[model samples]
Target: MAIDDLLDEHEQSERVRNWLKNNGAGLIGGIALGLALIFGWKWWVQHRDQQAQAGYAAYAEAVKAIGGDDLKQAQAKVAALREASPQSLYAQLAVLELAQAQVKAKQLDAALATLKQVAADSPMKPYADLHAARLLNAAGKPEDAVKLLSSYDSPSALEVRGDALVQAGKLEEARDTYLKAMTGMDVASPQRRIVAIKLTHAGGTPPGSAESI
Candidate 1:
C-alpha cells in the first residue's frame, strides 16, 4: 500500500492503544463497582424477604398462643419477635395482639405499656392511642382520656372525647363534640345511632331529629 496511508494507520493504532492504557484501570474499576452493586442489592432483598418470613412465622405462633389462652407463651413469642425484627410489620402486629391479650386478661396497665411501645409514626399508632384512651376512661381518668384524644379529629376519636367530656361534667362541650362526631360519621353507620343517643343525653339535639327541626 501507499507509505502515507500506512503511516496514517500506524498513528491511529498508537492513539487507540494510548487511550486504552490511560483509561483501562478506571474502566475496569467502574465495571467492578457496577457488578458489586447489582449483586449487593439482590443479596439485601433476599435477606430482607427471609427475615420477613421468619417474623411472620413467629407472629403466627404468638397469635395461636394468645388464642389458646397461653398468655405467658404468647408474651414470650412476641418479645422474641420484637427483639429479632423490631422494624418488621409482623412484629408490630404481634405487639398489638399482645396488648389485646393483656387487655382481655384485665391487665390494663400492662396493655397500656405495650401499646405505648408502638412507634409514633406507625400506622397502628392511632388505634393504639384509641385503646389507651378507652383504658384510661375505664380506669376513671376521663381527663387523661380527653387529653390523650385531643390531637385526633376522627369521628371515633371525637366520640371517645365526648364520652370523656361527659364523664368530666363538661356537658355542653360533650354535646358539641357529639354533634361534630355525628356530622363526620356516615349516615348509615350503626355507631351514628349510638352517638345520637349520647348527644341527646348530653342535652343536644341531633341535626336531623324532630326536636332540632
Candidate 2:
C-alpha cells in the first residue's frame, strides 16, 4: 500500500519478466525434453507389449497348423515363426515341431538341418542336441552324432552318446559311456534296460558288477 512497497513489488515483477525473457526458451525446452522422454518410454513399452502379443499369436497359429492335414503348410508356419521371433522360446518349440514333422515325412536331411540350426540357436540346448544327435544316427552319420552329443554334460545324454559311439566303432568308449549312463539312471527305469542292452552289444558282458536289463 505504501509507495516504497509498490515500487519494490513493481521492480520484482519487472526482474521476473526480464529473467523469463532471457531464460524461458531454455526452461521450455528442458520441460519439453522431459515430457518427450516420459511419453517415449511409454510408447516403447506399449510397442514391445504389442510385439510380444503378435509373436505369441503367430506361434499359436503355427502350433495349430501342426494338427491340420497339410504337413508342409504346418512346417512353413513353424519356420516362419522361427524366422520372425528367433529369440523366443515359442519359436524354438516351433522349430522342434517342424523338424519332427519333416522327419515323419521322410525328409531326413531337411529335418536334420533344422534340428542342427535349432541346436545352435536355442536356449533348450539339451533337448535340441539330443534330437539332432539321434537324427544324425538315424541318417547314418554316427560320428557326427557322437560329436554333437559330446557337448552335453547331463547324464541323460550319455545313453544316446554311448549308442552313437557304438555305431561309430568305439566299443570300449561306448561301454564306458553306457556304464556312466546307468549310474545316472534310476535302478528301475526302462531306460536302464535299454542302456544295458546297448552295453551288452558293445561287449557281451557288463562292466564289473553292473547287470544288464
Candidate 3:
C-alpha cells in the first residue's frame, strides 16, 4: 500500500475510536436501562400472579368456612376477603356465598344486610337481588321483594316475584308475571312445572268476567 493510503486508513480508525470513547458511557447506560425495564416488567407480572393466587386461596378459606356450624368464622373470612381486595372477583363471590349461608342459617336480617352491601354495579348484582328478594319474601315482606326484583330478568327471580304477587292477592298481575317467568325457563326445569301450576291458580276468573260483575 502507498504510504499516504496507509496514513489515511489509520486516521479513519482513530476517528472511530474517538467517537466510541466519547459516546461509550451513553451507549452502556442505555443498554443497562433497557435491561432494567425488561426485568422490572417480568417482576411486576410475577408479583401480580402471586397476589392473585393468594387472593384465591383466601377466598377458598371463606367458602369452606360456610356450610358448617361456624357462621362467625365464615363471616370473618368473607369480610377479610373484601377488606383485602374489595375490587377482586373473589371478594364479590365471597359476599354472595356468605349471604346464602346466612339465609340457610335462617338469619334473615343478616342475609338481607349482606346482600345489601353488594354494589349495584357489581357483577354479582343480579344474584344479590335475587337472593335479597327471596329473603324478603321469606321474611313476609313480599312487597319489598317484588320491588327489588322488578328490574331483574332472571327466570328464578321472575318466579319469586310471581309468588310475591300471589301473596299480595294481585292475582291478575301474578298470572302475567308467571307467564313472563315461564318464557324464561327451559321446558326441562322442574320449576317450569311448578310455575305452570302457579299460573293455573293465578289465572282464575278474569276481573271483567260475568261472575265478578
Reference-based TM-score of each model: 0.86, 0.73, 0.74
lDDT of 1 at 16: 86
In model 3, the Cα lDDT at residue 15 comes to 81
* Deviating ranges (above 4 Å) for candidate 2: 1-45, 119-121, 204-213
Tens digits of per-residue lDDT, candidate 1, 42-156, equal: 9999998897788788888888987877787887888888788776778788889899989889999988888887878778889989989999989899999999999999999
Can you write out model 2's per-residue Cα lDDT over 34-129, one digit (the tens) per residue? 999999999999999999899989989998997677877987898788788777888888888877877788888888877766746567767978
For each candidate in turn, give its C-alpha RMSD to the true structure in angstroms: 3.5, 5.3, 6.5
Ranking by lDDT: 1, 3, 2
Ten consecutive residues with minimal summed lDDT in candidate 1?
204-213
**Which predicted model would earn the best lDDT?**
1
As a TM-score, model 1 comes out at 0.86
Shift in Å, residue 86, candidate 2:
1.3
Candidate 1 total steric clashes:
0
Position 138, candidate 2: lDDT: 85
Residue pairs that clash (backbone atoms under 3 angstroms), model 3: none
CA error at residue 20 for candidate 1, angstroms: 0.8
